[model samples]
Target: MLEHELVFALREIALLGGILGDVELSSSELGGILGISQQTASRRILELEEAGYIQRKPGVKKQLIHVTESGSERIKAEKEKYERIFEMGSRMRFSGTVISGMGEGRYYISQPGYTLHFRSALGFEPYPGTFNMQLNGAELNKLNILRNREGYTIPEFSTGDRTFGSVRFFRAEISGEPCGVVLPLRGHHKGVLEVIAGENMRQKLNLRDGDEARLTVFLDR
Candidate 1:
């Protein structure tokens, strides 16, 4: 992998944001941020334009540099690469507020307030307005901390449980009160589920396809 590609891509985009508005950059400012000489910065800008990462508006007096869609895609791809490296390990970082929980089930808010339901810890309150956030733990641990170590736990996993129409345990934030917590989802169809309860008892809370649900997983024993 190109170790410096991501870093360079970010720096290039940062420079483009400011330049997009203005006609051009003072050699000193660009060089200062890049820690290179003015000549070097100018050369790199030309190279970026040639590579299609940016556009140069032809003008007699001054040249204007702007970030292109390709540049934005490069930045996005780099971020995904870095994120995947961190996610596959036990070093998952959680950033969101715990909204609500009951009996040790916690739900976190990461998307807008409209979107809830996540794999989180248990134990929290109905934190409605603030951006209550907690980080520092493996992905699962970060979620569980919201339950505040309440009676939230997982049993062993089984092949039969992996099938449909069954009750199973998963760690997810249903409410923000307890940020990282466990909530149960009823498996009715494959990869589709219903929250254990709806507005009325004895009914299943069906979820939409592509909806996000956090699964609390345990080892098969």
Candidate 2:
């Protein structure tokens, strides 16, 4: 479907609760919402239904419309693309002190399953450990916003009954070195940010426990 049609028709339907359940509305009502003619709205709805993006049941003056699973997926994919476009060239700053972790970073980063994706996505093999940072007040808020944005994702994998959670990484630079900000989907650290790089960040950046670290995260490649 055309981009504008998807944005104007399918997106509006989903927002009006069509994705969760059937929504009752007439072509005139949808046209009012879309600022288009009723004839156009009616045609768009028919097109959407024919494309398998929605199921429409006709009624006397209104119709029951429900967005299909395919429609939801299309909306989600479009949303992600828009998110990336919105964040392109944007920068987020982080100021925190180096901290100790529970030694889980090494174990998780060293796994071949995770490392393979890191190499492919981030353009380098990650070191076997993560550089942990204890984020401060404002930086923690920034991290929360970053979490909502789409980034490179390492999907969940399993090995011998053990399943690993997905991880998202944003391209970043720390002290003039290329790096990545890692956020594990199943992590418990609410105020901590883990950093990964091709080399040992602690030694390369000359960082120690309680030392201040600053990172600049770029939203795009």
Worst 10 residues of 2 by lDDT: 80-89
Put down candidate 2 lDDT per residue, 1-221, tens digits, no spaces.
Answer: 47677556999999999989999989899999988899988888989888788998877768999999999988888887678656644877788999988899999888888888778867888988899899987768888777877788788899996998898888888988888888877756568988889899989988899999998787664
Q: Given candidate 2, what's the lDDT at residue 29? A: 94
Q: Which one wins on lDDT?
A: 2
The parts of candidate 2 lying over 4 Å away from their true place are 1-89
- Clashes (backbone N, CA, C under 3 Å), per candidate, total 37, 0
Candidate 2 at residue 112, lDDT?
Answer: 88
Off by over 4 Å in 1: 1-12, 15-23, 58-62, 90-221
lDDT for every model? 0.39, 0.85
Query: Tens-digit lDDT track for model 1 on 20-121?
Result: 443465545566777878887677776776667666675565566667677666666767868855553332324332222232211222122212222232
